[model samples]
Target chain A: MDAWFQNEVTYPHVAQEVLDAADSVRATLPNKYCDPEIAANLFAEAIDEYLLCDDLGINVICTEHHAGINSLLASNPMLLSILASQTKNVRILSLGTLITLRPDPVRVAEEYATADVLSRGRLEIGFVKSGLSEYASNQASPIDNGDRYWEAIDLISKALSHQEGVFSWEGKHFTHRHVNIWPRPYQPTLPRMWSATGDPSTAGDVGRRDMVQVLVLRGPEGTKTAFAANRRARAAAGMPKPTTDRFAYAALVAVGDTHEEGVRMGEKLMWFLNTSLRSAPQFGPKLPGLAPPQAAPGLYRTKPAAAKPGETASAAANAAALMNITAEQAMARGIMFAGSPDTVHKQIMDFHEAVGGFDHLSMIGRSGFMTHAETSKSMTLFGKEVLPRLKEVKTVTAGYNQPD
Target chain B: MTNATALPASGNLLIGDIELEVVRRGVGQPMLLLHGFQNIEPDAPFLDMLGDHASIIAPSHPGFGRSSRPKDVETVYDLVHCYLALLDSIPDEKVSLMGFSFGGWLAAEIAVKAGRRIDRLILVDALGIKISGPETPDIFDVFNKHPDEVRKRSWHDPAAQAPDYDALSDSQLANISRNWEALCRYGWHPYMYNPQLKRWLGHIKARTLVLWGASDGIVTPAYGEAYARLIPGARFETIDAAAHHPYLEQPRAFVDRVSRFLKS
Candidate 1:
C-alpha cells in the first residue's frame, strides 16, 4: 500500500469569539484575520514537513482550497513545483487545481507539463470537481459544473499527451482554437490521472476513464458504495477488472509514542470539521446544483425531514454530520487512524478489512492548530513504525463481490 | 427531449418539445408574462388585478416552477429563441410581452429578435444591460452576498415582504431550489446581463415601459432609467415602498401601473 502525506496548511489562530460571530469562516470573512506573517510561517513549516516526508519516503500530495481558513495552499501547482524541485525521493501528486472554476484548461496543462519536467517525471496530476464556496469565490456556476469538469479533464489530457502538433478543442464547456503545450509531459504518455470525488453519480465516469478515484473522509459504508458503483459501471461497459491500486482512501491520521497522546492530537484535527466547515447557507444547503430539488425538504427545514430510504443525502448534510463528531466517533467511523504506532497500524488494517481494500492511503497529518513540531513527530513515527507493516498488505484484484 | 424528474404537471403550453407551467386569466388583448428569478406565484394578487385590464398568459420559464428543462435549454439565447417560438405559435395576433427581474433580460432579448411578433413590452424591475464601468457593478450579486444582505437589499419592507421560509412547504422549497439552479445556469457569467444587449436595445420595435421598485437595491431604479434610455421611446416608472419584487410587495400599485400602460 502507498501512503501519502498531506497537509492543508490551515490558519487556526483566529479567536473563537470571532468564529462564532461570523456566519461563515470561508469566502466571506475578511482577510485581515489571516496575518500574512503567520500564513508565511505556516507555509514554510508545511514545506519543511513535506521535506521530512521525502526523507521518510512517504509520497507527498499538494491540495488546493481558495479563500478559506481550511487551506492556505490555494494554488496546487505552486506547491507541487516546490515539491518537484526540492524533494528528491518522493512522488508529488497535485490533487489539484480547481479545474471547474478555471476558465482555461490549456494553461493548467502547461503548468502540469512544467512541474513534470521539474520533477523529472515524478508528477501525478489529480483533478478536484470543486464546488460550494468555490463557485462564489471563483465566479464559476455550480450548474453545469459536471459538464465543465469532464470537458476540462479531456482538454487537459489531450493538451498534455497530444504529440501531433496544434489541436483545436471546442467542447461544450471549454474552447481552445489553438491547443498545444511546449515540452509535453516527461512521462511516456501522461502522468497517471486521479480524481477525488464522493458522488456515486460520477464515480462511474471515473471508472470508465480509468482514473484513480480517491474517496476522502467517507466512512466504510459510503466508500464501499462509491467503489461498488465504479466496478458496476466498468462491468456494465464490458471493461476489464482493475486492481486495488486504482482505489484510494483519504483520512485524518495521527501517530504518537503512546495511544493517549495520539488520540489527543487527533482531537485537534476535529477543528477542521467543527470550525472550517461553517459555511453560510448559500454555500452549503442552499448551494445551487449541490443536490437535486427532491432533497430540499432535508435542506431548507430547520428540522430536516427524515431522509427517505434509497435517497442520496447531500454532501452538505454529510459535512454537517461531521461538525460535532468526537475523535472516538471519527476513529470508529474509519475517518481517522490515530494512536501509538501499533494501535494506529491495527486501526488501519481494521479499516482496510472493513472496506474491501484500498492500496493508497492519503493521510491528512496536519490541520487546524496542529503545531509543526507535532506534525513532524507524527510523520516520523508513522514513517518509522506503521508504514512498513502497511506495505505488507498486497494489492488484490478489484471487483466488488456482486451484491445478491 | 428527456423527461426530467420535474414535470410541468400544471403546464398548459406545448411550445415545440418544451412544456411550460402557464397561468391564463381574463379576456381581451394577448399579454405574454415572463416571470423573474423564480416562477411567479399562481395566487399573486397582481395577477387578478392585471387580468381585469387585459388577457394574461404567464408561463413559467423552463427549469422553473414545474416546467421541464432539457439540459440543452440553459442559455439566455435559448430562452429568447424559445419565447419567439411561443409568439409564433400564437399565430396572427401580435402579443404584448412583460418580464420581471431575470425574465426581463430574456424579454428584452426576445423583443429585439421578435420585432413584428411583439406589439408592446413591459419590464418590471428588469435586469439585462450593463449600465456602469466594469469595476462598479450595476447589479448586486445575489449569489455571492449574504442571504440577509440579499433580503435587505431586495425589499423596502423585508420584514413584511420576505418569503417566510419556515412557513413554506417541501414542494415550495423544492421549486425555489430548482429556480435558483436554473437562474444561475442562465445568468451566473457576465452576471445577469448580456454585454451586447445595450447596443441592440435600440432595435426593439415594441412600445416599451420599464417599471421599477423605488427601493430595489438589487438593481437600482437608476439602472432602470439608463436601461430605458437605451431603448427607443421607452417610458420608465417606479412604484413607491417597494424593492425588486414590486409586483409582490405592492400588488395593487404594480397592477395599476401595468393596466394604465397597457390601455395607453
Candidate 2:
C-alpha cells in the first residue's frame, strides 16, 4: 500500500468553480484557499503514519509527478531517501524515477544508486515514461518520449553494471564520452527494475529484460491480455518464464471499519480521480512523432466516437468523458477498491483470480481531500487486517507471497 | 500561357529528391509566392487576382499540402538553403518574392542571406522579430485554443468557412498533421523568431514592402510595424477590415496594393 503525503490543507475547501473549470486536469486552480504552512505539517503527519505502516509489515510505494498540485510531491528519489532514513526494515518502492525527462541518465543512475545504498538495498526502482503534462511543463517534446525513455534506461543500466568502470555512450537521444558513476550500486548487480505503463507491449518489453511490470489503471480484461502478452514475449525472447512477483497492479484503495465508511472515504478518492486525473492521463498529449505511426492511436487514446449528436468527439469531449466516470462505475469495474478491509480483500482476491497472482498490490491509500488522521486510519486498517490475510495466499502463478 | 484570367496550372515540381507542388499562372516577370503555415488552395481567388499582374509561382512549402517532405528539410535554415538552391536551378536572373505570415519569416531570412537574388521582397502579417516593449502573443498559443477561437482570432469573419476536418480523408488529415509537426520542428525552439535576425536586416537590398492586416490579433499590427521599422527603406502598409490572411479576407485590395508596388 502507498501512503501519499498529499497537500491536504485546502482539499476539503476547494471551491465548486475550481473543480468545474478543471476541465483538462492540467489547469491550475487558485491557491488562495491554500496555506503553504500547513503543507509541512501535512508531510510530518504522513511520515509518522507511513513509519507505522513499516512497523506493521507493509512495503510502501513512492511515485512522482510534476507542475500541478494533483501530486504535490515531484521528486521520488528525494522522498524515498527520506523514508529510507526514517524507517528500519520497510522496503521503499520508488514506483518511479521518470527516465524520459532526465537530461542526463547518468544522474538518474547516481541518484537512485545513492538512494539504494542509503536504504541498504531496500529500494526497488520503477522507471516511468511520465505523463504529457510533465513534458509540456518541462518543454520536452512528447514526440521523442518513447525513444528517449528506452535510450535512458539502456544507458542507466550499462552505467550501473559496467565492470570496466568507465565507458562511453553514443545513443540517439544521449551521448556522453565518459559514462561512469561513483558508489555504483548497493546491490551486487543493478537494482531490481520496474516499468509502469498502460500500453500492453510495455509489459513484454520489461518482461524480456527481467524487469517487473507495474500495471496501471488498465481494467481487468486489459490486465489479463497484458500479462499473457508479457509471458509470450518473455518466452519468445528465450528468457525464463515470468513469476507472479514480476507483476504489480496499482489501484486507488481505501479501507474502513464498515463498508459504508469505506464508501464515504471513496468520495474523496472519486474527487481526486474526477478532478485531477480527469483530462490528464486520459489520452496522452498528442505531440507529433511521440509514437510510431501505428502505435500513435493506442499510445494516445485518440479521439473517441461522439456520444452526443452533432457534438463531435473533440479534445474537450474526450476530457468530459474521462471526468464522467462515477465512483460506483469504477468500483464495479474493479478499477478501484474502497470498502471495509474484508470487502477490499475480496476485490483483491477477485482481481488476482482474473489476472493471475501478482505479489505487489500498489495501493493508493490516500487521495482527494483526505486528512492525515483519516488516511492514517485507512493505512492502519489495511496493514492490520488486509496485509495479514493476504500473507499466506500464494500467488497462483509464482506460488510465493513475496518476491525472491 | 493561358489568358491572365485563367487559373494557374498546378503540378509537382521535383527539386532534387524533394517534390514541391507548384502552381504557375500568367506570363511576365516571375512573382514567387511562398505560402504561410496553412495549405494554399490552388485556385484561391486572391492568387487568381494576383495572376493578372505578373507570373505567379506558388510552391507548397515542404511538409505542407501535397509537397514531399524530405527528412533532411527540417529547419528554417534548411528551408533557406533549399530555396536558394531552387532559385539557382531556375533560369530567371531575379524573382519578386512575397510571403505571408510564416512564409514572410522565411522570405526575410532568405533576403538577409542573399538579397541580390530577389528583385523585390514583400512580407504580409509576418512574425519573426521580437519587440522589447509589450509582450507579444505566443504563436504556440494557437494550439491551446479551440478551433473556433483560433478562427475568430485569425480572421475578421468569425463564420469564415474552413476545411471540414471531420469530413477530410485520412490522407488529407495526415497532411495537416505533418504540416503541424513540421511547424513545431521549425518554430518550437526560437519560438517563431530568430533572436539575432534584427541585426541582419541592414543586409537586405531588395525593395521591401511590409503589409499588415489591421485586425491581425495573431501577430498584431504592432509586430508588423516593428518588423518594417528594422528593414532599410521598407514601406509598411495596413489593409482595413482584415487580419492575418489579408489576401484571403480582402483579395481585391490585397492584389491592388501588391500590383501597384510591383509595377512601380
Candidate 3:
C-alpha cells in the first residue's frame, strides 16, 4: 500500500495586527496578509516535511490553487520539479495541475516531462479542471473550461507520448504546429495519468481513458459508489475491471501516543479545514460559464452547506460537519482518522473494508495553524507505529483490473 | 393606437449548419434589428413599435434564444459572416441595419467587412471598441455588480428594472443563462471590446448614426462619441434621461430618433 501526503504551503503568520491594518485601509489583502518571509520559510519547510515523509516510505503529491488566503502553492509544475530534484525513490505526483487554466499546453507538456525525466520515471501527470476561482483569477472564460481541459489533456498526452516524427495539434481551445517535445519522458510511454474529481459523472470518462480516479472530500459510501461505478464503466468499455489501486482517497489525519493527544492534535486539522474551506464560496461567481448550466449548483454544493453568513458559510459548514464528530462517528463515517497508532490503524482498516479498500492513503499532515513540531511528531508516529503494522495487510482491490 | 398586439411571423433560417430564429413583420424595406447580449423577447414593445415602420427582421444571434449555435461559430467574426448571409438572403437589395449593445458591435463588424450591403447603420451603445480617454468601465463589470445595481445602470425608471425572477419560466431562465454564456464565448477574452475594431471602423462607409443613452454608465456617452468619430459620415445622438437601454426606458423618443435617422 503506497502512502501519499498532499500539502500546500499555507501562509504562516496571519497576524491580527496586519489584518487590522489592511481592514483600516479597506484593502482585501492578497493571501490573508501573508508575510513574504514567513511564506518563503513555509515553502522550504513543506519541502523538508515531504523529504521527511520520503524517509518514512510515504510518496509526495503536490497540488495547486489560485488567489486564496490559505494556499500559497499556485504552481504545481514548479513545485513538482523541485520535489523531483530533492527526493529519490518516492514518486512525485502533481495530483494535479490546473489544466483548464493553463494558456499554453506545450509549456505544460515540457515542464511535466522534464520533472518526469528528472525523477527517472517516478512521476505521475494529474490533470484537473480545477476550481472556479482559478478561472476567474486567470480571466479565462469559465463556460469553456471543460472543453479547454479535455483539449489540453489530449494535447499534453500526445506531446509526452513517444510518437516518432513531428506532430501537430488542432483543437478548439489550442492549436500548435511542429510539436516534438525535447527531453522526452524517462518512461517509453507517458507516465501514469490521474483525473481528480468529486463529480460522479466523470467516472466513466476517467475509466475510458484508463487513468486513475482520485476522489477528493468524498466519504466512504460515496467513494465506494464512485469506485464501483468507475469499475462498471471500465468493464462496459471492454477494458479490464479497475482495482483499488486505480483509486485513491484524501483524508485529514493526526496520530499521537493516546486518543486524547490525537484528538487534541486533530483540532489543528479542523482549523485548517474551516479556514481553508471558507474561500470555497468565492469560487461560485467565477464559475458561471465554467460548469454546465444544470451542474452549476452541484459544483457549489460539492462541499457541505455552510452556516456562517455570506460566502464563507458553506465552506465553514463543510469543515464543521466533517470534524464535529466523536471518534466513533469519525470511524463509522470515515470522515477523518485521528487517534493513537492502534486506533488510527484500525480506523483506516475499517474505512478500507467499508469502501472495499483503495490503494493510496493521502494524509494531509501540516494543516491549519499547527506548529511544525506538532505535525513532525504526528508524521514520526504514523511512520514508526502505524505503517509497519499494516505491511502484512494484503491488497484489497488488487488484480480486480486484469493486466493489459 | 391599437390595444391588440400583432405577433410577428417566426421561422428558422438555416445558414449553413446554424439554425437562426428570425421574427419578421410589416412589409417594406428590410430593417434588421439585432438584440443586445441580454436578448429582447420576440414580442418586446420596441419590436412592435419597429414593426409599424420598415419590414423588421429580428434574429437572435446564434447560441442565443431559439437559435442553434454551432461550435464553428466561436468568435465575433463568425457572427458577422452569419449576419452578412442573412443580409444577402433578404429581398431588399440594400437593408438598414440596427443593433443594440453586443448586437451593435456585431453590426459594426458587419459594416466594416461588407458595408456595401448596408444602406444605413445604427449602433445603440455598442460594446466593442477600446477607448483611451475618460476611462470606460469594461462591460464585464455588470457581471460583478449585484443584479439590482446592474438594473439601475440599465434603465432610467428604476421601477422598470425590477424583474420578478420567480415569475420567469424555466426556458426563460435557461435562455438568459445561455445568452450570458454566448456573450462570454464571443467577448469575454478581450473583455467585451475588440482591440482591432478601431482599425477597421474607418472601412465602414454606411451612413451611420451612433446612438447613446445620455446617462448611460454601462458605457459612457464619451465612449459612444469616440465610436462615432471613427466612422467618416456617422452622426452621434444621445437620448436624454436614460441609461443603457433607451429603447426600453424611453420608447417613443428612441423610435422617433431612430426612425428620423433611417428616413433622412
Top candidate by lDDT: 1
**TM-score of model 1's chain A:** 0.97
All candidates: interface RMSD: 1.1, 4.7, 4.4
Worst 10 residues of 2 chain B by lDDT: B1-10
The full ranking of all candidates by DockQ, starting with the best, is 1, 3, 2
Model 1's alpha-carbon lDDT is: 0.87
| C-alpha RMSD of candidate 1 | 3.2
Candidate with the larger lDDT of 1 and 3: 1
The lDDT of each candidate is 0.87, 0.71, 0.74
The digit string of per-residue lDDT tens for model 2 on B215-259 reads 887888877888888999999999998988999899999999999
A127-173 per-residue lDDT for model 2 (tens digits): 88774567655556555566788899999889888867679998887
Tens-digit per-residue lDDT, A361-387, candidate 1: 999999998789889999999999999
Query: Candidate 3 residues A1-404, lDDT tens each?
Result: 66788667665366656544432111134654667888787888888888888888778899887766557787888889888988997888887778788788988999988999888888988887775445556667767776787889999999999469799887788989779988898888889998876455576678778888877656675666666667767878898666667777778778889977886787666655544444334344423564444432333325433332211122223444664454445545676688899888888877777666677787877776777787878888998898887665656553343222
TM-score of each: 0.95, 0.85, 0.87
